[model samples]
Target: MPTPSRIEHDAFGPVEIPSDRYWGAQTQRALGLFEIGEERFPAALIRAFGLQKYAAARANAQCGVLAPELASAIEKAAIELREGRWDDHFPLTIWQTGSGTQTNMNANEVIANRANQLLGQPLGTKTPVHPNDHVNRSQSSNDSFPTVMHVAAAIEVNGRLRPALDQLRSALAERSQAFADVLKVARTHLMDAVPMTMGQTFGTFAHQVSNALARMDDALPRLLVLPQGGTAAGTGLNAPAGFDGFFCATLSEVTGLPFVPSPHKFEGMAAHDALVELSGALNTIATSLLKIAIDIRFLASGPRCGLGELRIPDDGLTSSIMPGKRNPTIAEVLVQACFQVIGNHQTITIANASGNFELNVAKPVLVYNLLQSLRVLADSASVFARRCVRGIDVDREQLTTNVERSLLAVTALNPILGYDRVAQITATALRDRVTPRAAAIALGFLDGDEYDRLVQHPVNCLINYPTVNRAAGA
Candidate 1:
């Protein structure tokens, strides 16, 4: 076995616990147990947690509940955690027994131990910075965990997903304008229906993204409804009278986020409707991604036997047995990501609603689901957009050929030839492998003048590709 690297420091004095005691068990067990994997706590989440602790200290200082020196000490310890400086000290298991009591206690113990060092005292001492008294004086896991969730979600979305959306929109805009002259057959229920420019298809995608962004903007404010003022049971029992308002104002200033004081602290703490609402916005984004992924998959279906409207980049080996088979793996991954995001939304809803009147007992699950959903969405959206959507190349030849071969182009002739005559024109053209006008004239549907007038007077009348191209070119 390896020598014990147990942390000897305490919050107040020298370490008094033995090797067998659980007082220092966190450091020993956490380092030993989670050794199987190399994953550490997320740097972004740690930063946000540190900012929360810092903001909490400042907020408490306004009421003078947390003294200046102690508040400063908390800030120092949180800074260490944020910088990952105390990797050895943060040995508490990520999956703790008390529903994130370990993470919360990890911060408390770590901060308290460090603050005692600042005061020339042993670790675990509460004289300078009592982890619960001064550090978490006016806060609860009920409030802090969700607060960090919002902070991280907002940061990720603003930093990553929004930029990706803009990239996709811009790429589609350029593709739309580029494909304006290329005609393609639009299908309804996988059957040829109408003629449309491929550019028009891209324009529709752009509009859908624009609407998703609007929904995102509208849903984010609900997350700002926080439960910070509700200390234990939404009574402000130990907090000062005006601390809630001033705390929110100062916290907002420090974090550069708009933090609104909860008007209904009980509801905020007991119910995670805010989180559910935010997750629903993520579900919306996922739905959009799924639609876009579906479009990409359909457009790039096959090289010889499919629509093949666009070419997707082959990133890597798709199959072991098939030598030259490239797959839409990126779109598959993103679509699966969307599926999980929706599942995470449902988890949030069920977890939040399962709580009691004043506090949600499933805080760990709440943070886990919310963080997972936001992280996956923010990263996956950006990745799929830039790597897949933006890189797609249209096959103009394939698209135009498909459109030209489609018999639905004669639908515009219904006004001149009536529905029965138009159907006859399409059927005869398909059967004889000739132009619809030639087939129609052969069947005595019209004479030369009538055929010319019927096909040319109305732009929708049956016309061969060459004639249409010549007219368009002229």
Candidate 2:
């Protein structure tokens, strides 16, 4: 049997909305018009909408445009929405209107209907509270959606991604300290080079993460500047005089972030350059994470064959064809996640570029990709730090063997003996399958005592080497 429904009126006539839904005419119309994708807006964006709507009602009341009682009712309903009480009421996907007008209207309708219900009125009454006249007062989808986008992005980056990155950096720094004494041969272009401590290698990874975190912080101030007051065509049409200031003040008070009104309402509504800037930072972070994960997996390639310089944690995940074989599953997962983040950044870049004239029509897709990148990178960073970096073990035996067998150790003798002579000695050692010490001694280049003093002790080559803590600015 058909579900019980109620008729809701709008500018386009009547829309039959389900009786159980809190949404009204506009949202119901959008439900039928936009059947594009299964990817709905995330909870973060919805909660942001609730917060935005709540702040708008309060701002309107303060501006003497909306009645205090009506503002209180809208505030109560909007608070429920912000707390995720009516998530199902927002059923629009990210593939909807480019301006996100449909989703903004969705928030208005849900808040209005629920506010009426709060005032002892039946659903679809549109009586005590009207969605457009009150809930969305002094706001347009063009400005409101972008404002919510900035709020949601800033919250996720600060609350989730920054903490995750800090955790990962701390784990890497701990490992660097733990492996400070394990000396290994550094590789250049997959070939052996001079010797360095494993601590130095891990310290570099920590530094990269630190830089990524710094980049995120750098992008936040711009994100905090909102464009909410730029109603419709950036003219503040039909909005009160100080609506922008009121909105930002209330929003900042509720969110605990320093949100400020955009000085240029026209630029704020017309362009999304600030969000694009944040996406660029996320792109750099993805590149850093990908490099770190790939390096860890390469160093922990095999227990018997490949580099074998590091041992990955055994998480009970075994290859199907090979029993007793444990893979670097955590690092592999991180690498894949980084790849997805990189791709999402590209999508955001293109979407941001698609904006033209007074409003960016690609707001929904742009924010969707940006939030996805943030969530994925944050989750992967946490998992990698906890499961992989913390439990990684250094193969001291392999590192020692590789260091001793490396022909590039001749680099230490370049000052004592000329480069050409050292190269000749290394060539002879490799060709004869003998040690460089033997080859040098037979070639009359150095005595046993001199060779042992110069080449045998790799630390002799690291003249005035800085500690890992100093190198990493710890």
User: Each candidate's lDDT (Cα)?
Assistant: 0.69, 0.89
- lDDT for predicted candidate 2 compared with the true structure: 0.89
lDDT (C-alpha) at residue 290 in model 2: 95
lDDT by residue (1-474, candidate 1, tens digit) is 854433454344344333322234234344545444443445556566766777777778877887888888887777776677665544443454323455665566666667777778765345666767777778776667666666666666666667767666666666666655667788899888767766667766766676667777787787666677677777767777777677678667766768787887877777777777778888888898789788879988898888899888778766799888899888888889889999988878887777876777776666666777777776776777677777778888898677657777667678767999889988998998886667778888777677666554443322222322221222
- TM-scores, all candidates, are 0.84, 0.97
Which ranges in model 2 have alpha carbons more than 4 Å from their true place?
456-467, 470-472
- Residue 43 CA displacement from its true place in model 2, Å: 0.7
lDDT tens digits, residue span 137-250, model 2: 888998899999999999998899999999999899888888877888889998888888888888889889888988999999999999888899888888799888989999
Model 1, global lDDT: 0.69
For model 2 the local lDDT of residue 263 reads: 87
